[model samples]
Target: MPIISLPVIWIILIDIIAWTFFHLLISVICLKLSSTFFLRESYWFKIFWWEKSGKLWQKLFRVKRWKGLILDGTIFLKKGYDKKGLHGTKISDLKTFAAETKRAELTHWLSILPAPLFFLWNPLWAGWAMILYALLFNLPIIVVQRYNRGRITTITSPNK
Candidate 1:
């Protein structure tokens, strides 16, 4: 049996330590800085920031272009809300802003690390993985919002 070289062993140790530190460091930074990302409306919504169940989902199937997904989704959803008689800037608009802002903040925060980390994980994956994971994991909440808003529009519309 062949033994690993001293330099190779040192490199492995360094990589492991660095990787753990970087991962935890990013999570902490994101948590601390998240308050500035959302609205002041309610405490219930803040749970979205700290939820852990979505972590695995984000890691498994994060979108390659999350920024675009966010931008387009916000636009698409906002249009639906608008045509349904919802105030564009009050409800849907604010939600869109919060989602996009949070997405960008998380992506930018993760990008603060050195080049190796970004390249090693694929920049697209690293940047939008959280946002994608949030979408996938939060689909139920999204659907509820859409359904509730749609119902409100229906009940309030005069044409009905």
Candidate 2:
């Protein structure tokens, strides 16, 4: 049960405002940080033993088929890096692109952290819905980032 109660309309409004606020806040913060901050593949962004360099997602989720459907959110940001398509094949460009995938993935992961805050005012079901919304909204982008990062970094890696 919610610790506090609001009418349905108020709850809906709060959900919209809260989600938008958190999304933009996280995006802007991530954008301002140096791309080099994400340039190295952190543990969270690396291909796990289970990931098979992201091929696991392709096998289990058919990522290649639906990856094109993901809309790049950078268009909404005036200065954010556009990751929709690679701008060049140079090693420098590839490195930046790889870093950007990490950045994008981290942004979406951070975006989901606020979902539980909705439970403070929303009923049990709606609060759960918020968590679901967060996952549904972010997971596709997250998966695409992981998959692409692996491919990009593999090419960029001298050891590969």
Candidate 3:
């Protein structure tokens, strides 16, 4: 018997789409809530521990050149979206927003990990593929957020 029939393939595709949609919803909700609940620097937003991985992603995607240009186009990071005036352009507001934004980006990527669990009914390859797809889709976003946050931190630092 085939591992994945036509119907099964369609189902798998739908499942992937559903997971992607769910991930987006959760990410947005978390992003919004982070502003309210985690408005200040927290352990979750620490970059010291993840700096190596962030740098790896930055190098892999050359995020320095683009620096979250695609994400900036979205309303999430748009000016005045956070109601801090001028869309968080001020140094202090920008720093806080950057921290929350970084947390949101990480949450978005991490939420996709469970996607492969939905594919457990399918063959191993299907589950693995789902995992790979999740990583591929979110890795760039993570990299961009990390790169942008680093720059923002530098700008906001008092010594800088």
lDDT of each: 0.39, 0.88, 0.61
Where does model 1 exceed 4 Å of error? 1-6, 38-112, 116-160
- For residues 1-160, could you state the per-residue lDDT of candidate 1 as single tens digits? 1122235455456545755566455545544554445434344333242323234223434422241233322342232112222345555554554443344334334534433443233344432543454444345333333333333333433456
Report per-prediction Cα RMSD to one decimal: 15.1, 1.2, 4.7
State model 3's lDDT: 0.61
Error of 2 at 37 (Å): 0.7
Give me candidate 2's TM-score against the actual structure: 0.95
Per-prediction TM-score:
0.31, 0.95, 0.69
Off by over 4 Å in 2: none
Number of backbone-clashing residue pairs for each candidate, in the order shown: 0, 0, 2
Instruction: Name the better of 2 and 3 by TM-score.
Output: 2
Off by over 4 Å in 3: 1-6, 32-36, 49-60, 66-88
Query: lDDT tens digits, residues 8-102, model 2?
Result: 99999989999999999999999998977888657877767677777877888889999998877777777787887898999999888888888
Candidate 1 overall lDDT versus native: 0.39
Residue 43's lDDT in candidate 1: 43
lDDT of 3 at 81: 39
